[model samples]
Target: MMSFDLIGRLFGSVRDRDGRADVLEKLAQHEPTLPAPRNPSAPEELLPVALATKVLAGWLANRQQTLVPHTLNFRVLGPAQADLLLAVMAAAIQADGEIDSREARQLSLALRRVGAGEDEARRIGAMLAEPQHLGTLLTRIQEADLATHAYAAALLAINRGTRVNRAFLDYVSARLGLVPDVAGSLERRYRA
Candidate 1:
């Protein structure tokens, strides 16, 4: 129920007197109550669909369980794909979203399951610790080469399942300027 003016007094950014006055007048006329305040820098507050796709891609490509017991290999993915996925995974885990401990454990196990050695896994874990914006991370994914794009799209489709709608596929394909078949193939290959 606190007024904007009241909250603004404590929060320094709402300093424009005339603008604040207009806002206050509108609030007074409406007699509105304060909405939930958001943390300006919290990762959880921002989960743009694009960013979520990137995170899901990283989790699948680098963390999914494989059928064959292959030796842990960081070389399996190129640098661009690896970097993009690492950033997104870190952001998702930190996003004010709930990541069950079991899921976290599974993700850890999957990281090992992919045959990622201790050093590589630790390095990737370090990358996940780096602070990054979701938009920036998504930009990296969007900018990858065709091979990286194919791999990432496959992982995304697998992790997102039915959530990977036509609109989302089109968006990713358009961003890559790739043929629809490429994206479709990825979806088929990684069908959940």
Candidate 2:
């Protein structure tokens, strides 16, 4: 089975400047590896049950697919991993050194959507209510995709009529080990 770590590295490599050409070269040189199917019977302790259920439900809803609860295919994220993802996002929301009502609402909605308990969500909120250091939060990610997604989420929070700091963005991209172009693309897409 292709491990998540390996998958993350592969994704990072392919997200570089010559990503498409690199992918074609990789395909020509070797057989592509596929990820293992999501095993519903696998232990669910990796992710909190409520969170996992919510993720599965959202995925199904997006695809307009219906399946019995017990038979749904969902990838389970470790509790620590999930927490790190949320923390990174929280840091992003607070990246500009302030969290307005709109940002707070966005964070609350995100926490609820992920099925976080009030106490846990509040803890995260409290931590982010203060000034956040991008490097500190980016250090928590072990996977490139997680860092990328978290950064994307944070950018969304501050991309409205606000001046984004280029240095902060560059620092974050470097801390997360993302290709420069990927960060550039995100900046172009989200910059107001």
Candidate 3:
């Protein structure tokens, strides 16, 4: 419920704007409402694979700019598609018994592009700096049979504005072998 509301507010500029330029400008300068990381750091160990996957999905969905400053032309990818890509990358990085420092750094930098301040980046870095924690995270994720389903739910939450469709939910549920009840719950909760 909180995420649903937050997602709407986060996209309010795009939804409320009458001009495409204004929408794009607002998106370029969008700031997160949550307490995000200021820098990449070892965070409170994110033990749950499902939860971490969800967060990763959200991060990818909200990506609006490159890490490099003064770069004008934003990517043409939609939030849903982008979220899927990030989930894939994150899943791969966490699959092995290691979380590559370079990848973590890249992810942190990418997050910073979305308005994570120095302190927040450091906090995020702390969350990711530990390979061992990442290993455990992956293990937990592999053990949770519903990780893929959880990821789909996160994606739905992020894309609730424009494309909340039954077809998407059914496809994700089938792919992840989610129970009908759980799939239905996610659809009900996340649909715009």
Q: Highest TM-score, which number?
A: 2
Instruction: Name the best candidate (by lDDT).
Output: 2
Model 2 RMSD vs true structure: 16.5
Query: How do the residues 1-192 of candidate 2 rate in per-residue lDDT, one tens digit apiece?
Result: 446655676777736473356654665697667766667765665469779789888986643222211110112445665556666666666656767777777666655554555765766766675655656567656343476555554554443455553455556678777676566555555443
> Which candidate order results from sorting by TM-score in descending order?
2, 1, 3
- Displacement of the residue 35 alpha carbon in candidate 1, Å: 80
Give the poorly placed runs of model 1, Cα more than 4 Å off.
1-73, 76-81, 91-96, 109-115, 142-174, 177-180
- True lDDT of residue 98, candidate 1: 41
Can you give the TM-score per candidate against the true fold? 0.38, 0.44, 0.23
Identify the runs in model 2 with alpha carbons over 4 angstroms from their true place. Answer: 1-75, 112-120, 129-133, 142-145, 165-167, 180-192
Q: lDDT of all the models against the reference?
A: 0.51, 0.57, 0.43
In angstroms, give how far residue 151 of model 2 lies from its true place: 2.0
